[model samples]
Target: MKLTPLDAPGYEKVVYAEDAESGLKSIIAVHSTKLGPAAGGCRMFNYPDLETAKIDALRLSKGMTYKNAAASLPLGGGKSVIMADPNTDKSPELMQAFGRFVESFGGMYTTAEDVGISVEDIEEAAKFTSHAAGLNKGAFASGDPSPVTARGVFLSCLAALKHAFGRDQIEGKTVALQGLGHVGMYFAEHLHAAGAQLLVSDIDAHAVAEARQRFSARSVAPDDIYDVEADIFAPCAMGAILNADTIKRLKVKLVCGAANNQLADDAAGDALMERGIVYAPDYVVNGGGIISVSTEILKITDEKWVDRKIEQLAETTDKILTKAKALNASPHKVADQFVEEVLAN
Candidate 1:
């Protein structure tokens, strides 16, 4: 395993690891440790090449650092990415090998579920190391973190709504969701229960069908979702959908979603700002999953504690919006400032 510390300012450290037996190659990027121990999820993906995986890991880890600090969690930012096809490459032995790789870090990084990973998979990884979360255990169970993450996104949606429409209630509003996966479904359920109209889409037809029946969502084609007429656009799928082209087609006034690394590039946030769209930083609103899992790791297993932290996300969102408005800067810039302040101290 070769570990490299990126010379990038604001990012404290970065490391890459690989295991041959499981055909697993991973990059563990630790962006900061000023707040607390590094906390992030382990994402598994089938990258076209190692360079792409490294870039993904580095970008995600930096996002995690900003995310934890913005969410006011006593944790730093770090992430691990396994370069393998989740569809056919996952196995008990492979997961065990990954866990051992995690253990090699000596507790410097704690991991939970992310894309292409499940709670059960996390459990499999736990057998090789105790740093894994989402396992059923004594006095606490680290089950799925999506619901908690969705709650944070929901609250952030409200914050964005209040900023854009001057209303806190979604009762008569419409939200166009771009994914119906775990976090998206949870977000849709909450929004539907609150009497909000939901327009959802996903690459997986079955997931979309389930959401349509369960939440009474109006389904749209995945590619056409951005053009849907709605009060808010919630992108719960992959990142970079907020790039110049998609942003030009969006009919929503506000954008908030659970996906990490939403911006295609740093300049995309400015593009949203220029379009008069109230955009919430993806990292800020998506920290609930990591926060929930980290609380369990610290033995603060109370649901109320998790709820409180999630609720604080709304406050942070409000602050970012306010700062952005006052300074006439993009919310992403305002959020970056907040994270820089935390890391600097």
Candidate 2:
């Protein structure tokens, strides 16, 4: 494949790797390394085409840059995406090949887990590259970031509720939660314990069923999740669900969740604002996972430090929403501006 100019000109590196024998095709994007080596997760998907995969890689890597900066990590931003279904296409040979592909970066980009990739998969990658994180090898090795990420999202949602409803209470509120992944399940538990009603959906039937049993969550068809009438719409699934079409269908007052690149484009965020919907920027609200994994990478034993930072996510969310409301602008734009200011200094 020939090189095409990434619309994101600020990216430092973009790599495409293929091993036909192993059926491995992947893209790695390092958006920045100003603070330190770029670090993010490796995600697997069944993208329809290489261009689509490249676009997702570029967008997500850029989000990582902002996410790391906002989370105050000394690391920069990077991401990798394998263009194959993790369930059916993953293999030991493919994992090892992807590991070697990551090793080729020579520590410039370190990785953990993301959607469709797990800790076991990272262990396989770690065999070929020390750059892989979230391993169970040492005392400080972070195992899974989903719980921490869920906590951060929960905090941010409370912040959003405070901004939107003049109170920070979760009791008696109805939440339409899309996606029942690890983070989403934990988030539902948080809300359910707080007396919030949950309307849940996921591509994984087992996950959806589990959420229903665990939290008494009402199940909705995955595609129909957007139409649920609730106090908040939490998108824990993939990106771009808050576009023009879905924005019009939303019956919620606030939008908050763990999904990166939630807005299809900047305009989608603006559209949310025009419609009087409060949105918590995905990167800001979902920094806990990276914060959790970063502790392992930095070899820090201070759980207090991690807790303190995660707690501050509420304040961060409040600050962004307040500023956006004051300016009649999208929180997404406010978040980008905030990240730019952080990156600038």
Best by TM-score: 2
Model 2 vs. true fold: TM: 0.96
List the RMSD of every prediction in angstroms.
2.0, 1.9
lDDT of 1 by residue, 1-345 (tens): 344444555566666666666676777777777788888898998889877887888888888888888877788888889888888999988788778878877888888888888888888888999788766664567579999999999988888788898888899899999888788889998899999998999988999889889888899999999888999999998777888899999998899999999999989999999999999888888888987787667788566888888889988999899889999999998999898888787
How much lDDT does each candidate structure score? 0.85, 0.90
Q: Which segments of model 1 are wrong by more than 4 Å?
A: 1-13, 301-303
Q: Estimate each model's TM-score.
A: 0.94, 0.96
Model 1 vs truth, CA RMSD? 2.0
Question: What C-alpha lDDT, on a 0 to 100 scale, does residue 48 get in candidate 1?
Answer: 90
Model 2: per-residue lDDT, tens digit, 1-345?
222334457799998888878888999999999989999998999999989999999988999999998888899999999999988999888888889888988889999899999888888888888788888776778888899999999988998998878999999999999988878988999999999999999999999889889898899899899898899999998998888999999998899999999999889999998888999999999999999989877889876988998988878999999998898888999999998998899
